[model samples]
Target: MNHNLMDSTINEAQCLMQALQSAGFAAYLVGGAVRDLLLGRVPKDFDIATAALPDQVIAVCRSRGWSIIDKLGKNFGVTAVIVKGVTLEVATFRRECYGEDAHRPEQVWYGTSLKEDLARRDFTINAMALSLQGDIIDPFGGQQDLARQLIRTVGNPKERFQEDALRMFRACRFAAQLGFIVDEAALVALSEFHTRVRGLALERVRDEISLTLIADQPDVGLGILVHAGLILEECRIKVQGVYHPVPLLSELGDLVDVPQNPAYHVHDVWRHTLAAVQAVPPKLVLRWAALLHDVAKGRQGVRGQNQAGQPTDHGHDRQGAVLAEKMLKRLDLPARFRTRVVWLVLNHMRFHMNFNSVLDGQGLTSLKHWVREEARSGLFRTAEEMHEAFDQLAVLCAADAKATGRQFGHEHEREKFLLILADILQSMPVHSRELRLVVDDIFQEETERRLIGPCLKGLLLRVQDGMLSNERQELTVAARKWLKKHKQL
Candidate 1:
């Protein structure tokens, strides 16, 4: 666990190690926990490796009256033991044998020595362990690899990947997470076995990609995937007896060297996309939008020529939105997340639509209407959601403008949008229910009562336009006038 985030979990984990030692078995903090400690980074979780058999580990837990889960332990030689409200995964040292399946081992037999367990691990950086006596165990030069900031397999890279193809993805993830370079041999092994990713599950691929998106240097990991041909080529996934080829971020690879209007962009589309991805805060949805914002810029239908003969990509935003939705759907992302990201892609260019009017000393006359209409677009359910979602959009637009590598008045425009948002939130009514005129007082007839909702909506728009005050008398008179106009129509 992260030393900063989970001090209690660390203490309890050491306690469990002590307990296992007292029961006449060897226990040590192992795998990523050891790697993180050596790197001086807080680990997300702690995993323990022990010389004790799975049954013996369970017996120790039973003796201490701690909650234990032995189901996976019974078959896979791993047990989940909960101590003082923290769940620590304790596994027996084991060796695994794999068959045709790329992920699950065909057979698992517990080993007695920590060296055997470390040998079977995927990477050298993760193969090290820390004993309860505060000693480092480096069987395969893991400490040296860590010092070199390298990712290399324990034994043979091909052998390790064949046992679990998911390690190939982890190789990319760890490279991004730790800012480390993959050993040359491991890179070759990854490309040769890249096709093995298809034999894995979809959720596993999605989870890995999701983690990579938020990494310290996502471009590093993503570039690795592209180098392996995994992003451009296909990884087949089967469902309901039919197979679908779902390559992660399928069009991303094509963005390489795609020229932009050079007067506006210093880098090509690929570099610009990476810059935007890095420009935004490490938020998943915003980062995804940034990555795909210009996705369709160099495609056939979208690519065109301007009057100046410079390259132009008209309507790329709309086309990119469609492609992004399809890509995210293939990855099986949530509907809500896909919708928000698609909306951001679709509207990334619209931030400047009405801002010119607001900046010309004309006041927020047109901008207020834009905010109200956007708030009513059914994407958000409440006024608070509208504010928050639009704030995210503003932040995204600012990032996009900054990533252009040009000095535009983007900060000023973003700040103006925030000011308008604050004014709208404080004074304007976003929904019909917030109108000053009461529905009961407006119409007594049951049939006419149905009109109140729509009538209030009309008054809300007018009030937003500064055509009527949000007072009872003014709203009541405007509502009658609006009703008269609606009846005639």
Candidate 2:
């Protein structure tokens, strides 16, 4: 640990520790902060575990005028305090029991020793702690596991997992986050206790899944989850074999060396998706789209031949959208995000189809119509919104096309489509034109005199055909005669 980084913050932590020591209570910096410092990573948050009771810790914070946010209602046995704009969490060393392998102990025994407390932690890497004065505490050889870049349970893996089934998912999440390998013993335990994860709450499972998906090398985490049989247990979705097509996006700025598969793809789906996601400016909606763009490929894939004797996943985009919706809903995702993801999934293949069909035939007119009439109709409100959608769609499509490993056959066709899309994107206005109505003209002579009644439809048809000028007086006279004859308003 760097002593220079431990300045006033160390003093503050030490002050808290000194107060506890003066009151005859032991305290230490625990969990992620300790782990991160050892790994030379900047800790996002700091935590403390102490022999003092929660009430005593609260009293100490109150004496210092620190604001404490209690999470005891959530059964976390933790409280967060803000000091000099930095939030620190403090928890009491305690023992817990789970009767059914899902919920926490119905009762907790507080004032436990640090070794006993460390034994209760989910993983050895997280079980270690550090003193305010830079002393390391390792009751379970967590330091050894940390040095080995291994994730192992503090005690019996099965027992740790049975205590809280969500810990299984957390194990995967931590491995993904830190780029560590799960120990063989832990992996075997995970395989055996996989079914226990089904007993966990959906929100807990969903949160861990999200974290794993967004990790530095998400595929590693996901591969472990699948190998351990936890995905089927937690997700209730059966994947027949290993060739699943859904790719997890890696975290930003993480260098991943993805193996090239030159026969069918320039890059694997995982790396392609990661690159595609990075190409788009980061937005929740766009990122979700990029991540789920090809979800249907695995399900819709055909091994042998179609009617035309060619391998095909026809209508995969539509099928993928359906699958994406189901997956997102299962995770309890927001409606707005679900809708955007579905939209992207459904239209991911559109650009390819347009480029192949229209751009190669004659000119850019059909492509333009596709954009203006079909794509712009309800997909976006403003032209700028349409451009953003198009740009993200292009990135996803290009990645998908690149994954196909075909040359696309027509260089002019591809160039034209790209150029036209770029031109439209650059010139597109930022806002849509508002619909304006001449209220007075409609309400006065024409409407009042019953000139704009049902019978006026034919007259309006004539006006649209240029037989009558659209001037108020001309419309009023035409509407009056039609309404009088119809005897209706």
Candidate 3:
């Protein structure tokens, strides 16, 4: 336990506890806040579990000149109190009776005993509390579980999971966030009760998945989902005015048996993906792209044999993009995010294929051409946006290479690509429209205007290649010289 963290958390919430305690109600800092404080981590927010009823809690806040949100308090005995600009949730100690929703409780009743409130929590680690005096009120051995680095249900695993099926996802997320192992009994319970996750709202499920992806050990959380067969289950997504069942991660499971050439890869596609996901920064987009980048590998007609009969996945990138789009749609992610991830999956192989050539100066010309082509396709709005997109793609490529578990020249390749990119971006024209030499500019006194389009295109290429400037005077001179040579002057 870090005394500094405990003292800071206690000091931050002391006023609220004092207000509740002064009103003759028992108050303690509770749930994840206490758990985090004990682990030497700063809690995101402080929640106070108290014996005061909703009305009493609101009245106490009013007496202290604090703001109170009593909407939840009116129904669930949970009040949000804002003191000195910090919002503290003060929930009257309560036990809930959950029905079929798999998320919310159908009934709730206030209780005076804090032990009952603690027992009703999802896991032992979150069942502890701290009084205003800094004493721990742990009736369920949450401290012991923390010491053991374990995640176990507060009571019977089945009963806890049945009360709220979302607890299953929470259990996996906690394991990932804390790098703790799930207790055996809880693991068993999760596997047995995994299907109930389908009953959850898609938003709740998506939120949990996002948290897991950003956690310190997302692979651990995802592994649990896989082991419990939760990924095999389907979620409902409305498609074209009809509801369709889409398996959440069956495509991910498909990667497990997909073989890669032993010379370049030490693990199957699945393990490589996990490694790449872990290696990448835990941003949601990068992680999702890394996890799904090779999703089409080993699928029918996607996997093939090269000249040496080695395993090859030639069109996996294109196919993976299609699959990623469907998966993102099933998750109901925003259109912009889906578009970016799909683009990434579609083009992730570009760097790997051209890295060595670019480093050797053989691919720089083609690389610039490709960049211009992508820009003209309206994939990015400006040079800056284009640079940012490729930078992210470079990051994904680096992770992919590292995940191969082979000594590939990813760093050198990335350095060379960025170097070439810098030179190209210095004056690279995204489209012929951006060129100073428009058709009218080239054919100012045109006797024959047929070559005007070709003339401007040639000028744009010359400018992109750094052979000429994009200035109007310079482009006009160059375009006329070209047309004169082509017999159209």
Q: Which candidate leads in TM-score?
A: 1
For each of the candidates, give the backbone clash count: 3, 1, 0
Model 1 scores a C-alpha lDDT of 0.82
- Quickly count the clashes in candidate 3: 0
Q: Which wins on TM-score, candidate 1 or candidate 2?
A: 1
> What are the per-residue Cα lDDT tens digits for candidate 3 across 1-489?
334545677454888888889989999889999999889887898998999998898898898799986556468788888888888888889989989866789999988789988988999999998887778888889999999999999889998998888898898899889989999999999889888776676777778878988899998888887777777776554558765655677788888867999989999998898889889898999989998999999999799998888899889999999999999987889998998899889988876777767877788777877776776677776667777778888889888999999997746657867887776775777667777765675565656487777777787667766799888889878877887898732
The candidate 2 region of ten consecutive residues with least summed lDDT is: 246-255
Q: Alpha carbon lDDT of residue 154, candidate 3?
A: 89
lDDT of 1 by residue, 1-489 (tens): 234323333788888999999988899888998898888787788899998887788889889889996556478888999898998899899989999887889999989899998999999999988877677889899989999999999988988998898898898889888889999999999889888877777888888878888899887887788777666655567889986777777699889899988888888888888888878888899889988899999999999999999899889999999999999998889999999999889877766555555676674666676676776677766676667667777777777777778876656665876787677765556676767677677687776777877887777778766688778998888777777677666
TM-score of each: 0.89, 0.73, 0.88
Residue pairs in candidate 1 whose N, alpha carbon or C atoms collide under 3 angstroms: 1-43, 2-42, 2-43
- Model 1 CA deviation exceeding 4 Å by range: 1-9, 70-73, 236-238, 241-244, 352-366, 421-430, 433-455, 464-489
* Weakest 10 consecutive residues of candidate 3 by summed lDDT: 1-10
Cα displacement (Å) at residue 252, model 3: 0.8
What's the ranking of the predictions by lDDT, best on top? 3, 1, 2
lDDT of each: 0.82, 0.66, 0.83
Worst 10 residues of 1 by lDDT: 1-10
lDDT of 2 by residue, 113-200 (tens): 8887888888888988786666788888888998899999988888888888788888888887888999898898888987776556
Higher-scoring candidate on lDDT, 1 or 2: 1
After the best TM-score superposition of candidate 2, give how far the Cα of residue 184 lies from its true spot, in angstroms: 1.2
